[model samples]
Target: MMQSTTGELSLSWSQVAARRLVRHGLDTPAQGARPAEIVRALCGAHAQVVSAAFWSIGLRSASLTSTAVKDALWSEHSLIKTFGPRGTVHLLAAQDLPLWAGALSALPPSHNGQSQEVRLTPEQTDEVVKVIAAALSDTELTIDELSEAVIAATGSWAGELVMPAFNGMWPRWRMALAQAGICGALCFGPNRGSKVTYTNPRRFLPEFAPVEERRALTWLLKSYLSAYGPATPQHFAQWLNAPRSWAKELFNALSAELEPVKVNGSLAWVVAGDSTFPSSLPQSVRLLPYFDAYAVGGQPRELLFPGRATQRALTPSGQAGNYQVLLVDGIVAGVWHQRRSGRRLDITVEAFEQLSATQRRELDEQVERIGAFLNAQPCLTLGPVNVGAHA
Candidate 1:
């Protein structure tokens, strides 16, 4: 139980964790919820690894297979694959793109350190974005095709081999790809053969139009708080990779819509009328994939990554989601990995401490759930995970 402070609702770490698990749809599977609903609930699912993104959604949904998730993205057009929070690839609900696009496009510009020769000026960046948007409108194009179109639309300057990529130098104008996505100019199309493609988001939601920035930010802040609340402005700032000052200002501007409360002596905020947390502690066990939103978005880091999880589960800088996590009773209790061979999936788990029989049984059930999501036979191994982060 939480010790109460005068005139304010007080919460315990356990209560917060339990409430978060419920809000995240992990405590009890949101039975019959569509993939888009799951994605919308989490704000977005990290999709740098497409498979990881599927599992992140699958785990929270009842009996949803990865095929359903793919269908939502490729066939039904219920989800949009694009740059989301922190300028990373994510699977966002198609219906919410207006809000996300507006909020993200409103972010203050960030500095990406590159030599002046390699970097695009603000004007050049705008020009490249306009060209890219024009090139992609109502049509899908591979990166190579888009690159050719961009250089032709702009000039030889846009084609200069400057930005360093893993293989070699990339063309200069390619730097604006994510920015174009942020501005509602483009989104991912289904891959053609082995090549990735980009297209205009308007093809999916023809009525799509970015909501006004202030209104969009208000919606985003409320959604973030609803899913991962009792979080401070710094947490919100870090999650969005936005300026802390800007986040503070936004939080202050919306003070009347928010309620302040103390969680174990630390201050945080929740939606004004939604500050109550569940009284009972949760006992759910889950296998969360890399960059899972629940693992990455939850705040008051020390509480989520208690003791050994700090050393094992999180990156040295304390970033979560670099490694796949094992959750017991709504908190990280171990780490795990999966490898697939033919129709078989092998999972290895490394617990910070021995799990009770019930926890072990629940862990087995969780592994089975993963297998069902992937349509593979599963084998569980209990041992040290020799693999490193994001292996």
Candidate 2:
């Protein structure tokens, strides 16, 4: 008998994808996992684009309706949309907001090196953060109203930054909004007619006490490995937008709980005892939305988006999400676009390689799944595809 001390497992990209897909609740029906579990698995969904957020969760939990996702954020108060990891708007479970806030707050302010034109001073930023929390405790207010409250609290200087912008003239306090969300001072409230609103996160998460900073962040790394494991500290650092040294510190602190694993000849870490792929795997085809967790969370993007898919999915600048992605046999195979008219949803696909007959049939089924998920008639336009184009 051979005793295994070093936890090293040889794994291929497909094997990783199979496990990751199931872990993300994409391999089964909606009942496969609850919304909170789904969000927890991928850390959180990139919800900067609300539609992408809906589809990200929609594609995973086929049974949950758009209305249900919104209800989860509003009526049920199960989901929270706020500025989370990487300093972007994300959707996470309300119960988990405190831990996210703790970890995010542990990092310094994001606007450290920003140009003075848009930067808020330390005192002004602190006042803005404090005012937002106080004004939103029980009442929901639009950004304008919140800005007013912040100005009242911090003086007119807080809103003095003026620039022609898409939304409106942004105030100096706007620069502190991301930090505010991270500090648990504010979370999205219901829409005030056409404007987005904010409220105290404690409204829905009153009992949510933030754990110790190190403990919460360490748990975050643990969860990161559960889904996107066999990934390097560099990957975790990039995902969280923290310093590489900071990430390494956290990994070092959690060394006892992580097992060494080899990913494409390089060393990475996975939570101990979970360094292998599943016993049985199912074939899969998926249409993932912009900044979808699967595409964002999976590591070794060079392997996940090989060859042609790489060029189109990622540009020379390295910015992704030029278009929606098409996943077949657990890899990104192409790109797609969709439009809606009345109750009908029209979709177009651009493939990187020649898809087989069975794959084509499966693509048709995907159309139906998306249709039911959106409560609309799905009409697909299929042809030989060239990855980046919308139609």
Candidate 3:
């Protein structure tokens, strides 16, 4: 469907959320969408905390077990965890890593523009990337081992390279390592103890071919729109950690493939041909994990939440970051956190509004499913936290 500048398809916020639930595979069981399909569908699952991504998949897929998620990453090589959009660790489809990496690598590192912040020297950055690429050529190394390798490779300079971050000194070599993760040279491996190990993506993707910048960005945006469509330029840029101007420029450049749509009376663009959703779709309840793309991807929180909903879910810094959201009828109706003790799991759900009996029943079933995915016996608690309701 095409919409002129003056004429656009109008959609209610509820309609958009319903479409997203369907698109993200939460509305119906996408039986075939394993970790790879599920992550790719959401433009990669936000995985700053890896366990969250595991649950993100289980919530979307009917049969994905905790072991299945790990197997897909380390054994089956179907998924790869790497730094994706916004320079955050995301679990992405291994087959699509090259394109994702190419597009992300094209964007300048977010730290470079930190004006008053002392950053890594360009020479030091280059040396660190080279060392990581060489040391991890066929081997996986935890951050400590990689730090040792960088120190050994670059001598004293590596040790002296440190930057101010989180009110403490962080190894400047980490910047290059992060950049390499964005550029596709490195990805996560199984954790050794409590430390994450890194290895070259070439271990499974030896046939990786470089993608042109525009082509890769185009591919990524289209996929993003497919899953998180009817999104504004600001939403795309914010999701990618790039400036809004870049998003606007890309939209203008790719206008032919774009279609305008109205989002709860506001304007947005979706890839052409996907601008419509059935007027009536399924109402669903889900437990979306921390940073699950579906909860964090789409925007204009005022529409996604009831009054003061964003205030209830935001961090201390006032960002609408999803830590484990409760989705009722595709809107963020509650928030949750989990604790695992051996084979026992405890989940606490903080509902913004009192759930109806039907919704409560669904919540119970969902919690049980989450426990099953983790191979644990689960106990549930539900209540409104102080911030859950502003009234």
Query: Who is ahead in TM-score, 1 or 3?
Result: 1
Indicate which candidate wins on lDDT: 1
TM-score for each predicted model, relative to the true structure: 0.97, 0.92, 0.92
- How displaced is residue 261 in candidate 1, in Å? 0.5
Ranking by lDDT: 1, 3, 2
- lDDT string for model 2 (107-211, tens) is 745554667766777887788888899999999999888888889888888878653358677777788888889888898887888899999888888776667
Clashing pairs in 3: none
Quick one: RMSD of model 2? 2.8
Q: What tens digits encode model 1's per-residue C-alpha lDDT throughout 120-154?
A: 88999899888887888779999999999999988
Report the lDDT of model 3 for residue 357. 91
Q: How many Å off is the CA of 350 in candidate 1?
A: 0.9
For candidate 2, give the lDDT of residue 89.
88
**Candidate 2 lDDT for residue 115:** 76
lDDT score of residue 295 within candidate 3: 66
